[model samples]
Every structure is written in C-alpha cells, then in structure tokens.
Target: MADLVFTVFTSLDSYIEKPGGVFAPPPWSDEVGEAWSNAALARAQHLIYGRVNFEFNKGFWSAAETDPNSIAAGIDYAPKMNALPKTVMSRTLTGDPGWNGRIAGPDIAAEVARLKRDVTGGDIFAFSGAGAAETLFGADLVDEFWLMITPQLFGDGKPLFREGRPESTMRLVECRPLDVGSVILRYRRASEG
Candidate 1:
C-alpha cells in the first residue's frame, strides 16, 4: 500500500502564501533545489489539485524533461508525476487524456481511500497550499507531513491548519536545516484515539 504525504512550502511565520494569494517561488539553488527535486520524485504517486497547481506544475515539470539545467531535469519527477497513478480532486475539471488524469467529482474521501488501497508501493503526495492541504487533513487521511519551512516570514497570510483536525496529533519524526535558513521537517500522524 502507498503512504499519504502532504508537502508544502511555508514561511517561518506559519503562512503558506502572502496576502493577495501571492507565493514565493521556491528557492532553487544548486544544492537546495537538487535536494527538493529528488525529495519530490521519491513520493512517486502524486495527488494534486485539479486546476491551478496542476497547470502550473505540469508546465514546469513537463518542460524539465528536456531542459538540462532546470531543476526538473535533476529530480525526474515529470515522468513520475505524469506516469504514476494520480487522482486530481476537483469538481470543475474535465480530466484530459493528454495529462492522463481523471475528473473526480464528489465522494472525495471515498476516492482517496480507494487510491490508497490501490497503490502497491510508493506514496500519494498532495502539493500546494492551504485549500487542498486542509481538505485532506480534515478528512484525516494524511499519514505523514513533509513541511519545508522557508526562512522568510509573511507576518500573516495563508495557514496550513484550519478547523476539523479530528482531534488527532502528530509526532515529529525528523528535522534538518538546509544551507539556507529554510528547513525540512517531517512528522508522522500519531495513533488515533
């Protein structure tokens, strides 16, 4: 079975985005970018937002397949995110055959759980900010969280946690600081009460 992982780029002040829905492009230094690039590829199975994030990532990653110096080339996530079984949670999207995606209307929980049972190995990862992250978290379906904390602080903006966390908790399993002030933190969901 595959593990459910949610990863995001968050500022030190606990904001995923600045006011007006603006986001900092991830720092892609040779070392840091390479690390993040490989980290994403390891997830293997990608569960993503249907429209905005999908279009954005699809453009960059699909291009990385050819661009040598691009971070996409180093990680090899393009083909992985494209080829691996994926479920895009969206009511507004009509999954195009070109992207090899399916339109999942309602029954979001049922669909996610089904995908979990379907995958033999690897992992299912949710990308982007509060909206999609909150949905999966509220459903209590996420098994692990890989948060990349950037050094900058947005003061007040987008946040990761909202209401309806199921009264559960997580135990910090790992923490590593990169060359830059940004850090990588990993947590595993604690057993449910």
Candidate 2:
C-alpha cells in the first residue's frame, strides 16, 4: 500500500494564495524549482490534483517543457511532471485531460483510498490547496503533510486550513529551512507516532 502525502505551498500567514489568483509565488527561482522537483521526485509515484489546479499546471508546465530559456531546474522539472501519471478529481471535466491523466469521480476520499491500495511503489502525492486540500483533510485520508512555508505573507487570501473540519493532531516528522527563507515542515497523522 502507498501513503497519501499532501504537499502544499503556503505564505507565512498560512494563506495558500498569492497577491494574484496564483497559488505558487511569482518570479519563480531556480532554488525554489530545485527544491520542489527534488521533493516531488523523492517519493511521488502518482500526482493528484483538483481539476482547476490540473488545468493550470498542465498549461504552465507543458509550456515550460518547450521553453529553452526557462530556468534550468524548471525546464528539467517540467518534463518529469508532465510525464508522471496524474489523477484529476473532478465531476465536470469530461474525457481526457490532454496529459497522462484521467478524471476521478466525485467521491474524493474513496478514490484516494483506492489509489493508496493500488499503488505498488513510492507515495501518492497530492500537491493540493483549497477545495482539494479540504476534501482530503476532512476525509482523514492524508497520511502525511509536507508544507513549504514561503517568506512572504498575504493579508487576506485563501487559507490552507479552513473551519468546519474536526480538529486533528499530527506528529512532527521533520523541519528543515532551505537556503532561501522558505521552510519545509513535515508531519504525519498522530496515530502513526
């Protein structure tokens, strides 16, 4: 069985959104790209996302794969990301996602559990935020959380953790600060401690 890992990028204030409607920080850097790529490659067997995030990433990274002038790490990362098997959880998206991906049904939790059982290697990683993150968290299916805390903060933005979900506990696995001001905090379900 595979573990389900939810990896998210957040601002210092715990917001997952930027000044614009983007999720990742603007003016991407090689350092950030390298960190993200390394982390993703370390244990990800399947990449999962919500429909909206799936489309956005498909457009951006697909273009990055062909952009000769793109950052070195980003250029390298794009192909790896694009080639990875993906599952987009959406009810409305029809047919193919134009990438190596398929649309998952409405039952996010059950689908995630099925993926966990089906995988033969590595972990099932969801680079998630907002609705997708909330669904997985509320379902109590996330085995681990890997959060990257950027140095900046947004006064008002989409929060990583929302209200209404029952309170849960986590066991700290690791805390590492990157060369940049960004920090990575890793945790697992408290029951696994």
Residue-level lDDT of model 2, residues 145-187, one tens digit each, is 8888888878877889988776788999888777778888899
Clashes (backbone N, CA, C under 3 Å), per candidate, total: 0, 0
Best lDDT goes to which candidate?
2
Off by over 4 Å in 1: 64-77, 95-97
Model 1 has how many clashing residue pairs? 0
On the 0 to 100 scale, the lDDT of residue 14 in model 1 is 81
Q: What's model 2's lDDT at 179?
A: 70
TM-score attained by model 1: 0.85
CA lDDT, candidate 2, residue 188: 91
Model 1: per-residue Cα lDDT over 62-139, one tens digit each: 666667787767664456765655566665766472455666558768877777788665777777567777778778
User: Model 2: which residue pairs collide?
Assistant: none
Scored against the true structure, residue 106 in model 1 reaches a CA lDDT of 83
Give the range of the ten consecutive residues with the poorest summed lDDT in model 2.
19-28
